[model samples]
Target: MDPLSPVYITGCGAFLPGQPIDNEIMEDHIGRVGGAPSVFGRRALRWNGIARRHYALTPEGRWLHSNASMSAEAVLRALEAAGLGRADLDCLAAATTQGDLLVPGHASAVHGELGGGALELASFQSVCASALMAAKYAWMAVRTGEANCAAACAGEFSSRWFRPEFYEGGALIDTKGRLAMAADFLRFTLSDGAGAVVMESRPRPKGLSLRVQWIDMVSLAGRFDPCMWAGASEQGRAERDGGWSRRGPLAAHAEGAIALQQDFNLLKAVIRAWIGVYLDKVDAGRIDPRAVDHLLCHYSARSLREEIVGLLEATHAMIPEERWFTTLTETGNVGSASIWIMLEALVRSGRVQPGQRILCIVPESGRAMVGFMMLEAVEAVR
Candidate 1:
């Protein structure tokens, strides 16, 4: 990790559909919503307390796509909204586990636009640890005097699926069945969009001060990899070519429910232990351990998010009622873009005010990275 001070977020902007996906109409999409009480109203009220969410997706949320480079366009819009232009940046960077392309990252084109500037181009990816890494790199660059300003952008090029089957490519599930369809299109909770933050050494009049104290990381390699993927095989000529190359959180050719439960338990324990240490470290911007305004985490499934919500409530790290972002219900699993999406929600909801401390816990690669930052509002140009 690059050594840096508690950096500040000077400018912030995001793109979600101007309209929101209100819960009142949720059952219209999910099978579970059908038999649930209030049909739509009660569940909408309980669906993570989210009145509506933004999306850069189609009306059905069944397919995944945007005008190519839509996120880049979002960056332009975000920067303009933040009162920043190519002239004001020091670096252009983006993070993602799932990207449209691997070599030339989403930032390459963004950097290309800032002609004649001294801004460097960088890309960081760690499954779900992307945005934090990108932001950390930016903060370090500013603190080390490497750059006067930087743009830390993050977005997810999510595929249309939720069954956890495609994690290992093989046969495709027919999207015709209700269960199969739900498995494929679960990103409604996530409005595919781009978000950017301008980081600077000198605070501008209308910038958001995102004081990041520290970022800690630990790995449990060979842990969830097995749970999420399998390479077992059958004895056949066809199997020789196709077997042992499969992946997923779904049951393997031979994976049993017991194995699934054990793996799930391990992941849960990993999160609990890390947060235990994180919470014990120090005060989080004068807020009570139990009073944490919200918990922004990587986009996990609905059951997992609820499970974590219970855990946070039990440990008093955050109140259950404060679970504001539910990607499972909307965006499916956003891979690495989950945390940034939640942060955007906070900004849009007007819940994150100057000096409000928010905690973002990113659990990926069988490890967890904890980021605690304090937000200070920036001056906006009329």
Candidate 2:
């Protein structure tokens, strides 16, 4: 198989579970769950720069949907946009930090929701960068002629994992208190959503499509510890885990609830991950800063976005303020779904045109992973 076979993202879609929730509603939820955020938590919320986020749970805290349901819906919309159906799919790859279940894989759940398609299916869990990593694999499958049509998607049911009761259960005491607080800080910033894109070996004529020129991802875990994490740990490990959870400290096993844990060096992590990756790309001649037409980034905080933009401009005269794009403020950090949401917003804004270049940067703090893609928008081939 030729390594250079063309692959195109012919269609994209997203499903935001419910109305966007604001800080006020968030505060009310916390109150109802029996925990008042500490000053640090409240300040962290304000400084996080996310005003609203969509969640799958109701304000009264009801489970409305799972990752599989939202992802299936988004995939259908993407297939519709691509002018194709499930039968056309050669493969389906689903990614998420939060899956509907632990054993069967998110892809299986999605396949069930998609009415049991006869195509290939798989799932990935790599923290926040899972979606793009899945997309990269999907592109490879098509480029290698393993599939003609493929879908890469991610959906996160983050709201269900949040354990407000744990916070209110007097976990905030002594040195462990600040870690718990930081976890709450992250919980407040996370929202639930799903996004999907349909990729094809060939593009349709006279339509919008994005051609992937190149994409690269690097793990900074060994170099840094952002440690923004949730979920279970080795039950018997010496490391006491972090994040929100319903399981008490005395529980025999890890149970329901999302655990939030983070180190305080988030700003440093952002600088190192985002800026460091871009500079490395430039140094390796993989990217020409001046050739980047548009810049899309996943920075949950406004300050991080601004700082990255400033640093990039100072380093290379490439990205301008007008070309920078994100949905963080309105959508909050929808985890792995963020990049696709930003792409959709870019398309809706009508700022992108055929032959224009787009550079998307994604960073995840769960042990620090950074992924960036360089692509060119093109008129579809018939």
Candidate 3:
């Protein structure tokens, strides 16, 4: 195995739970937060421009699929597409914001659910960049000859938190009788799904494979506070004595210490930080925007997309509007799974051609993290 061996994405698969839930029927699945429709939810839906999304819950809001199960299913599909069995894998890496169990890691749970021979496993827990980090690990493993075949997958089960029952006993509305903006904003924007990819040192025998050109990630946490988080009552409290762990389980739950929160005020800073990283990559000659045939960017909302466009144009690094591709409106924001799902959709669409380069950009506002991956479509080796 050559140290400089190129890693190829041999297969891509996605598992979107349940049917496409339209905007009108969203509440029917997630239910109203305070026993009634939320005005904030309605406005957020219109602004986010997500027409439909999937949820791992039924109309009754009961559990339909756990995070681990979804990731396993996606990995199985990816393995099938790669023409490999579970026994062929040397490493399994998974990423997610959270899993059903708190003790075992997400990758371990996915491996147990997948049921295969013992293999090296890695789990990444963060915001959206988790998936890219997992993919980078698999790519490095294959490139370094540490693994002949590796799989990286991401799953997001955010619908459970969006459910009204999750916040039933908590004070969801302010004293003005309005739902909290942070909580309501995400309910309409985030959804559930999982995506997986199989990576190997060589391309597949009879299909298109994306050769991994490079993967770069940057974190700006030192200059920014947490923009999106959970399992904490306040920004810096998660590390202090006032953290969620300090409060008893029941007390924490009752006080809404576990709710997913976002600071909209920091969104502009997130965009700027992401662009700064991109500029650095460009300056280092690692990326040439004009060489990218397709741009797959994971923007949480349409508004954010516009902001990104403005910055790209201002910096003269724009990839052109026509070259950009996204499934956000149709799939919503799947967090760690968004980039994988978008790539899977583009590959499955039959639009990509051999030798075309696809650039992927994923920005995470958990503390302003950004990931960039470049892939080149190549014909399968005979």
Candidate 4:
């Protein structure tokens, strides 16, 4: 078997539309609910600790469609961070569960908006797990020598289609709000946003290499399938004349409840399997699970995070004190972008150090868990 060596994440960037809304205003919009805040509208992220979120400005300064606007900005930011340019791009992979539209993938539209990159490109969507999946795909491309550098962008536009029926099937203009009205809760809290990560294979610079090695995908599909479906609403019915449909919120929430359970079970299995393989097959080098210093995990729900962090106290899978970095208080759940966002935060905070092993575990459908265990690289001595 081939040794999946570590791939370096050379750059990272994120973008939120301007005119950020604070938690107070966000609470007000998620709905006061008869003088009391609705329990779940914005409950998922209130104390997530994000200061503000950005959205786009229309001609009249309104928020634009979440995916396209945020995606374009994020890609540019990552490229700049890598000290590279569009000219250096070898591949572009756009990932999003909430896209600009159902028929035409957001990537095609975003590619056009970016003045049409000359590099090869594609789109990836695995619901909330897109970030890790996208990253895995990008890293694989480089690992296989298929590309020199790859960029993956994930935008969480969950709010736009809070009502799966309307978002997936069709949408009707809301006479009251002048926007789609299926989920009133979404309008207030779901800020349009995007995040991007640049992956490349770089030399070790006379020291330990910053690398991503061994991404294994494990899927636990049945638990979350009932909650997963294409959104099909009345407006969508009207738009398609009964063309498509989406998963309802109740089902979504049910799946949400179970999603983390499935994620945890599957992640443990994969890690054990990886270690077992190292001992039985690749016996020369064994990775000490304890050597893992950072774990970037997929953000499922606020409660799920609380439970896992509490339970994993011994291994330091993560800590409750780090909830702010895990749950995305202000950002809410940007689906596939969640883990990448956390990883990005660590990089920006300067917490990740050379030789420190970081494990980024992301969960996808069919019980697919992508694990990227990397050894940090020594930065160039300036």
TM-score of candidate 2 on Cα atoms, chains taken together? 0.88
Q: Would you give me the overall lDDT of model 2?
A: 0.75
TM-score-sorted candidate list, best first: 3, 2, 4, 1
Where's the lowest-lDDT run of ten residues in candidate 4? Answer: 254-263
Among these predicted structures, which one has the highest lDDT?
3
TM-score of each model, paired residue for residue: 0.64, 0.88, 0.96, 0.69
Off by over 4 Å in 1: 1-6, 17-68, 112-118, 160-169, 172-191, 226-295, 298-302, 316-333, 365-382
Model 2 C-alpha lDDT per residue in residues 261-341, reported as the tens digit of each score: 555566465566667777878888887767888988787677666666677766764567777888888888888988887
Q: TM-score winner among the candidates?
A: 3
Q: Report the C-alpha lDDT of model 1 over 1-382, residue by residue, as the tens digit.
A: 7554345665566555434556655434332312332222343244333445544444454444441254455556556755677677767777765455535765675565444556687887555666677877777787788887777777664422222333223332222212222122332333355566777765555645555555545454423232221133222112434333354324443332111111343556666655565566434444354445555665355555666667666554564554454444443344555566566666667666665556666766323444444344433323
Q: Candidate 4 local accuracy as lDDT?
A: 0.55
Model 4 segments more than 4 A misplaced? 1-6, 27-61, 162-191, 203-209, 222-224, 228-288, 313-327, 364-375
Candidate 3 lDDT over residue span 1-382, tens digit each: 5558899999998999999999998987888766778878878887788999999988787889999999999998898888988889889999999887887899999999998688999999999999999999999999988999999999999999887777766655565455578778988889999999999999999899999988988898888878888776654433666556778767776666678878898877878888888888888888888899999989899988888888778776778999989999899999999998999999998999999999999999899999999999999888
lDDT of 3 at 338: 93
A best-first ranking of the candidates according to their lDDT comes to: 3, 2, 4, 1
Better of 1 and 2 by lDDT: 2
lDDT of 3: 0.88
lDDT (Cα, 0-100) at 382 in candidate 1: 31
In order, what lDDT does every prediction score? 0.51, 0.75, 0.88, 0.55
